[model samples]
Target: MREDAVKEGDKAPDFELERQDGGLFRLYELLKEKNVVLYFYPKDNTPGCTKQACEFRDQYEAFARLGAEVVGISSDTLESHQKFEAVHHLPFTLLSDKGGRVRSLYGVPRKLLLLPGRVTYIIDQTGTVRYVFDSMNKPLEHVSTALEVLKTISHERNTQNV
Candidate 1:
């Protein structure tokens, strides 16, 4: 397994992936104005992935209140992502890593029988990764954890810059 594919204080690698909404999503461009939660999952409409996506959807407002945007990336196509979003009412961008290039760049390991493991990267507004949560627990919990980490990082940054 590739360890520490990304770390705190390191500039996040940029990418332009296709979004479910039929547009391009440039990582750096999106991070230009706000923090982002980039999650990589295995497939669309899977049990675990679906649960996690819905969790993010339910807490979409909370993430926004903290000036953070959640974006999910997977090896699935944009069409699959679109269907998943429409079915779940997900209020976030789902990026298509059709070639798995982004996944490889992020060093997300393949799971049993060639599946993408669950990995979440919490990046700050300046494009530095602040936290990474790699877990397959209830997807909702990951959103909460990301929010908590963002709040903590934001608070610390403000205090230091004061």
Candidate 2:
């Protein structure tokens, strides 16, 4: 496997992309409000990607309760994302990274250096990457791992306040 270009404690590379609704989503802008769960998947409507998206969708409320926003990114076009969102009833924002520029920027290594990689990044409000989970085969594990990391971060913050 290729080494990840970004890692925990690194400042997440900022990006702006067109969301499914055609509105631009700036990474730093979203970071100002809440922690961001940014996930990259291979394609829209594919079995693994669909399962991963729905898993994130199912756990979205839990994430929000913990002050995190879930955002998905793919090389798929905005229209494809729109249909994917609607069809899956995904509540979170899906961004279009048409050329996989954002993915490449993050150094999300492609599976076998061919297919797009599956990776999840948990970035704190300050725009630092708190955690990263990368696995092409274990799609659903991304949701569980991200939630665990967020909960840990929340707990740490709470303890620090006391």
Taking all chains together, the TM-score of candidate 2 against the true structure is 0.97
lDDT of 1 by residue, 1-162 (tens): 468477667788999977887888899998888899999988899888998998899889988988899999998888898899899999899999988899888877776747787889999888888887777655667788998998897788789999
What is model 1's C-alpha RMSD?
1.6
Q: Per-residue alpha-carbon lDDT of model 2 for 3-76, expressed as tens digits?
A: 75789999999999988988889999999989999999999999999999999999999999899999999999
What TM-score does prediction 1 earn? 0.92
| TM-score for each predicted model, relative to the true structure | 0.92, 0.97
Candidate 2: list runs displaced more than 4 Å. Answer: none
Native-referenced Cα lDDT, model 1: 0.86
As a whole number from 0 to 100, the lDDT of residue 49 in candidate 1 is 91
